[model samples]
Target: MSDDAQTPTPMPTPNDCDLPRRRSDFATFAEAIDYAARSEKGLNFHDMRGTLERVYPYSEMRADAMKAARQFAAMGIAKGDRVALVAETGAEFAALFCGCIYAGAWPVPLPLPTGFGGKEGYIEQLSVQLDSSDPKILIYPAEIAEMAGAAAERQGCEGQSWEDFSERPDPETDLPEADPQDICYLQYSSGSTRFPTGVAVTHEALLHNLYGHASGVNLGENDRVVSWLPWYHDMGLVGCFLSPIANQASVDYIRTEHFARRPLAWLDLISRNQGNTLSYSPTFGYDICARRISSQSNVAERLDLSRWRTAGNGADMIRPDVMQNFVNAFAGAGFRASAFTPSYGLAEATLAVTVMPPGEGIRVELVEEERLSGRPRDLSRPARYRAIVNCGRPLPGMEVEIRGEDDNPRGDHQIGKVWCRGKSVMHSYFRNEEATDDCLVANADGEVWLDTGDMGYMADGYLFIVGRAKDMIIINGKNHWPQDIEWAVEQLPGFNHGDIAAFSVETDNGEEAPAVLVHCRVSEPEERIKLRNQIADKVRGVTGMNCVVELVPPRSLPRTSSGKLSRAKAKKLYLSGEIQPLDLAA
Candidate 1:
């Protein structure tokens, strides 16, 4: 065994000694009110104006939540009743969520889904999801109330717009008390590829995870996060919103749509607000910064970011160049490389699996590609291409193991399945028992590990993620499959047969750039040129990336022994330049 493998790392656990538990102490969401009440600054909601609008002082938010709780109780929402929320981020979403907790109901937060191919496509996808979960009540914005009401009617459930729901008087009823084990919220996965799975989180689980994260990351009342991540995503919901609330901190939010339209607005918001701690979009946002940072005269000089710490990099591949570009661009603004925290997490793990400890700085390990691909190779020799950026170590209370095909632990630098188990692992996938059992597993020792379905290894104490065990392509923060893109391209003429294989090739651009590769089979030289240009255009239309299309001869494409288009194998071949590339006119 190597020295690296022999090293034992300490796990993160709640400082129960510093803050021991008490039975009378609040364990569940019902107790969250008391928790907020104990805080000095009180609960605040910062609106788009950057004004500190007090929605509820700790006492007020609690009172409103209690009022809403009474109304929910009168409406016959019992404990465990799943309530879906489809509103944007605001005091309403927060209050509704807390109200659900006070009423002992489960709040299911759904991002206002839009931007599909068309309205019909959006409605279809929304209908499919509604059928899957089958929540009893749907709360949405007044503008989309009719749509939600119609959808709920179709699903045989009750639906009310936030306008009407908030109008009901506070009922004179006793709110149900909740235990620590009671479910708090159902956080649905982004569903970038397939149907979103609702991850059930208990009150104890959420509180423990939030407390662990806030303290471990050094977030406190003094910290302020400038966020554009959608409130529906785990990072935005749990990390930015809930974590800040738990710590009595403040956050400034930019609507995801507004940020998308003007990425520069995100930086401007941060600058204007003097946000001290925050997150980011991937290289795409870095590209936006590279474009605007130079044009905006003395912007960094104007913005005070010296207090800004813990700028987490995740929700997509972490591109080293992007981080470097961001740091270099804003170095004048007081952004430190030490503040860049490249983390590993998933919705299933309640948004955090492992966080690089603050102030450790970012670390990358360049390993031999052959060794990483499961073949034995010289470990000491510097490889032509290597994986970069070790994503620090796992969080406390979490155990990570790299196992080979036989489920035995693999040595350092050997790529295998990344498995983890801890208090943060979600309870189960709502309504999908088989998937819940398959992904969430218990070993003989009785520790339940969630199969991350990602392939990587640990070096020293840091965890490095390589690729997905599943054929999922993550662009930006969204996951897509080559098939999803391929299906979109097959709609174009001259590209119908097993003519194309779409896969992501790792780039030196750090982790953010998952270069999209389209291998299309074309016959004649002229046809190949035309087909390459045509395919790139089609893919860009669908995926919003300048897709690199390489035209090759029919049957030249690599495949598995079973004749399946192996994306992993194709990516390997592309990196090695084994496949022929038909020249296209530039």
Candidate 2:
């Protein structure tokens, strides 16, 4: 490449984004890379400003990975030895991840700093995850070398920069052979990270999920991707990056940090890129994008989402209202409402369990509020409906069902815990037998099922997730979902998603009561009191319970590495007084 081409640029190039799809199946990630290397298409990494930093095609990536694997081997990385990588959105991370596969080492992806907290906070998060993985070595980007070193030292690991690791001499060594049962990596999603559970995903588990992803998305023609999801997360690691590589389809990426700064650029890349793009994000991503574009003039003429065929929503509950607003805002730019594909999955099931059939879009079922609360629908009471989005059928080779408290399958339209069985189910949590046993169990059919720990109901083979089982709040012997309260508070003016966190807090009587921690920018005490009261009124109106509304400063509430609201952590912090409320009442 020319010197200018080697460096990143702000300009969008039409020629580099589209690459022909090659293979759709692989025995392992290594085999997929081996196959995809013959193709000209690969991943393009973007900078914090959404500028294209580097274009790494498959052939060159394979060469780099092979050499990196040799370096890893020279450094005494053996088969099944875990190599922890501080995953950033870049070529180095991609190369090291694949190099681990080639070296037969399990790559444990760790999160990068999102500035939610300062250096110490990031170090704590990194050290905790590193300790859980217990890797001998940690590889990290040079930019965060100091923080990575501190975290590595805490975990008794030797830390090295990605630049230093890449420059190591390549030893001409025989590659370690891996079997289908051999581990691919240790997947640590947000839920996993907060709880410190490392899901042991084998090669077989990963490939099965990818194949199902290909089949579920109908990946024969016009399947390209543009994503800002972080690689440490499953949807980003397996779905956007690995799935596209295995299928030999082209993908473009912006850093997760960058997406948080400029979410519109994520859509801008899609609008400017020349291909049928398939991208996935949580409801917040689309909401943020719409909010950004709404303020811009000439939005319709400037943005083009016509070719965005699969606009997927996952990693959290799908918000139909936010999606509808997005469609209404972007329809002038040819964005279709049918492009919304709401799906559900967790790290334990590898990645995708169910995907909406292509072109079927967001299908919602309006169930009565009484029936949802596990009570008979009384005609005497006025009917209130909760619109649960259909998350579609299970992928090929996957079985999904809703099971009651007795552990038996529930009938259609009955709300209960979600259970899924498939080849993609994780083998176990690495070295945590007790934890693994709690979730993975076998039935008379000899099929192992993963208890998703999510409450949902099935209708005509589609899954409708209500809320996380652990996150459900019980007040006065009635169950309430945190999302309902959070969404309710968001409906009030001056609030949106991420602005508030709703959970259960113990009262003076030691009974559970509703609590909401809201992010407030209002400085005057009167406005703050007014806002807090407004939030409490709305929440009480919806939940039928008095709520303690505490107005906190912006960015005070905690979030997962993937930017999902961490109600569990938020509650812990609040109860411990770590999250001090702004003095709105005063």
Candidate 3:
């Protein structure tokens, strides 16, 4: 046979039916990995074009992790020490993260440089996180050595590429013993409206959340996962990475950057999977994929989505219209509407708070504008409503509550701050006692409840998120969600999601009013003026007040590391005159 014919076909690890599944029941993550290593399933890394490049079985990963643990011990990486690692979607990161747990060290997964930010911006971002995490050493892929090294040096931490670190002598050494209550890892909050804070999660909390997540999703023998979510985020780390090791399931992964470049390649990977697939993304992921296909394209000929059992939506607000557009775009290709699974969660909760039950799809309720705004209905005005998606019930060991400003529990259909109490909730914000106390409160029974700073209501036991509590704009004692204003502007011709940011600003008269910053693509001076007037009118129609409107250059709005608009940062930059708005006259 010729060389091409002689080469073997690449295959991913098998999801064996003979092996019994465990829902992260182990006391420690190290133990979980130890047990999972007995199985053949693990992570499969893919290229940008949806082609499998490496098949890393659990058995091999465990072996690599053991070596990494020995190396860490030789380097004096003791128990409870934080070791920061840039979360690249590959086998090296997987091995290093597991090795940290095996060595009894707490792994801190940091974000890679985002597309919008230059090297200096990324270094600054990394430096901030490094200062907060205070890791003993920073390990990253060699590609970003210069940038990562600069950040590490600025933070006064040791920095080395994983490639070089792996070459060090790793004599067999005894790893430190771990307890169920020992700190497992530090997850940075991915909030779009606030600075990232490291949330400390214990082994007990991590396992509890993972077990609840597996049960909530009804993880089965035949189910496989395909994903492109960044590992720095909780949903990708705890849900896709760590959960798979504990639950003994195989996965296929494409880098988040790769998915951004060619989003449909994610679906192409799902189509190639023979078994039932579980994939997830934020609402924008689906929106982008749908937008990539033209009305004239035959999706049925290019894709087969009938085997996709769970299409999870989380890590951002779930948009029902976006979900509908996806269904409309791919329904002919056997994509079932029932595959849409909406969920609610945060990093402070260790990951999942509520997961929609399998096969329910997206369920929405028509919440009136008055109810959402917490204002009396204006009877003279025609009733307007917003469709809020049901984010599903709490996990098995999780408890959900809606609390008002008085800290008293609210009844169903009353909007309030959403609170959850569970073993899965994060132990504390790392070394930030004041910030931790601000969110975690103790009740009469001495049970600590997490004050999830999200505004939502429960209806018939289903949670419906309204908006962020901090992002609420109160003008003249009336509450208005920034989403309402942004959505209103989006309805105007030629705008897209995340194209507008709305926040409260102090007016010239010393009164608080809503200000909108829009990303304008029109360059003509006259058209820019017209567009500004159009946006101002749209905002007035929605908020019932004249507001400040500024049209900015395209791609000027700040985004969080996870690619969500950072409204708080945008406001700060705009107020500081850093994010200059376009001069319509010029």
Candidate 4:
């Protein structure tokens, strides 16, 4: 018999009822990890079938991290040096990330190669980010050594596989201490593909946001996390991974790819857990699960979600229709509508600007299309409304304001640009002074504020998001949100969320018009033309004008690293002739 066969199956880390939990109140993240190591709670890795594979205790993780820190010191890693790491969901990545903190180097978490972007595309993305970060070394999993190495070489930076890097000498060396104001890490925004900018977060800012979010959720006894979110994204890395450690909570994690294959396995893991569960995802994750279960039977018999106390929704616009569908599909499985916690945040804010308080599900306000478009109501036309989801109030110590075009604060229920001010806001876009100056504005009082680039409004202290300011389609001085057009087309038969990309394009007549690119599945030419015309009419009704509608093949629309639809990239690709529309019968 093989030694592997004889070895006993590993057990997961305990919930650590004996240890007193801290809400990331520590001075630095290194200190947070150190305190967490004293407890039994740690991270647990799961397979695609929701089976536990490896048990990583915090004590063991800290020990490994120290060794990694020593190895880094031996390699002449200096304070504030950039160590680029491909954010993989595992203990190795977690340990190395902490080790960089211990060594006083800023750990930069980059994305792994996604399914949509081929090898060369991933390599190019990595190379661009590496050039922006100017890292001393790039470390990634051995499985993608060839691609990672190529990217690192292209940018003239040292690259080593995690396995190879770990095998190096770990000589005794003193690690540097971290300060609250010192740069902790660099996080590249998920949508930062064409032009990348690294957002530098300090140790203080990270801990502040973590503590605020933990307090906002009222993290207490029996509260644990179950997540399949990719660590490369801000929500996954800060809210799930780092926050769990600082708060001293055990976590169950499934790889994002695994969850993509079997989303129900996420619920399976939650069902098996005895404690109160907290899981978060974008609207699409819930949409995918609800759609996948439609063709199956006996869902309630197989899954249980009664213990899911916090079902967080963030990283994208919260869709009320999608949320209702999820509730309809899983309410029988003990999923409560009240557990849905919608939040609003960005990478620049270090993860969360505001998180819905517990017990408040998806709250929304019905705003007239005229108000949303920044135009007066036209009495001749019937009123059209859009449901804007309330994304909760600001976190403790965070301030939110909606500003008009004059850069003055707008009143309640007035749609304008969203701005946030807090200690949790990022220090700057690393090495990009021009970009930093463009977004981070200072008042006469010398208080700095972050322009979130999102358009929203305030009502009774709650925030209701309209859409992205950059995504607003302006035609003949009338502002129209692409979401409005996309959601209108989705109302038509045979369409899904993320199936359409809408933007403004200039026509041959020197007039700007709305252009809708839809993912069409029908192969017949006549049906394609019908679908195209149907979509065009739907868009026309929304915008009150004729628009360009093209049917593209399915699965061609570009998505950000975190799986959010990238309309900017879609428009660029369509204009560059990279995204070809299918031919229809004349």
C-alpha TM-scores of all predictions? 0.75, 0.95, 0.98, 0.98
Candidate 1 TM-score, true structure as reference? 0.75
Clashing pairs in 2: none
| Per-residue C-alpha lDDT of model 3 across residues 419-507, encoded as one tens digit per residue | 99999988899889888998899999999999999999998888999989999999999999998899889988888778999999999
Worst 10-residue stretch by lDDT in candidate 2? Answer: 10-19
Worst 10 residues of 1 by lDDT: 10-19
lDDT of 1 at 401: 90
How do the residues 1-586 of candidate 4 rate in per-residue lDDT, one tens digit apiece?
8766766767777765687888999999999999999988899999999888999989999999999999889999999999999999998999999999999999999999986668998999999999999999999999999999999999999999988999989999878889999999999887531247999999999999999999989998778899999998999999899999999999999999999999989989989888999899999999989998988779889989999999999988899999999999999999999999999998999999998999999998888999998988889889999999989989999999999999999999888899999999999999989999988999999999999899999999998888888888999999898999999999988888899999999999999999999999899988888888888888878888999998998988999877899999999999999899988963
Which ranges of candidate 1 are over 4 A from the true structure?
1-26, 40-56, 191-194, 272-276, 280-287, 375-383, 472-501, 504-586
lDDT at position 344, candidate 4: 92
For residue 297, model 4's alpha carbon misses the true position, in angstroms, by 2.5
Instruction: Compute the lDDT for candidate 4.
Output: 0.91
Number of the top-ranking candidate, with lDDT as the measure: 4
Model 2: residue 551 alpha-carbon error in angstroms: 0.8
Question: Model 4 reaches what TM-score against the true structure?
Answer: 0.98
TM-score of 2: 0.95
What's the C-alpha lDDT at position 544 in model 3? 89
Model 3 weakest 10-residue run by lDDT: 188-197
lDDT tens digits by residue: candidate 1, 1-586: 8766844532211111222222222466566556654544333344444444443455566777788888888888898887888748666777788888888898887767554224554455456557777777888888777566767777777888887899887758877778878777888765311236778887776776776666557664345566766677787788776765565554566666666566666665556544355554433455456556767678566665566677777665555655776777788887788887878777788877777888876777766545444444545654434446667777767788998889888888777888888877788888889879988888899878888887788888778976566766665655444544665666676543244677765456555333444555455678767766777787775555776676664555653211235466566666778665656542
Each prediction's RMSD over C-alphas, in Å, is: 13.2, 2.6, 1.4, 1.6
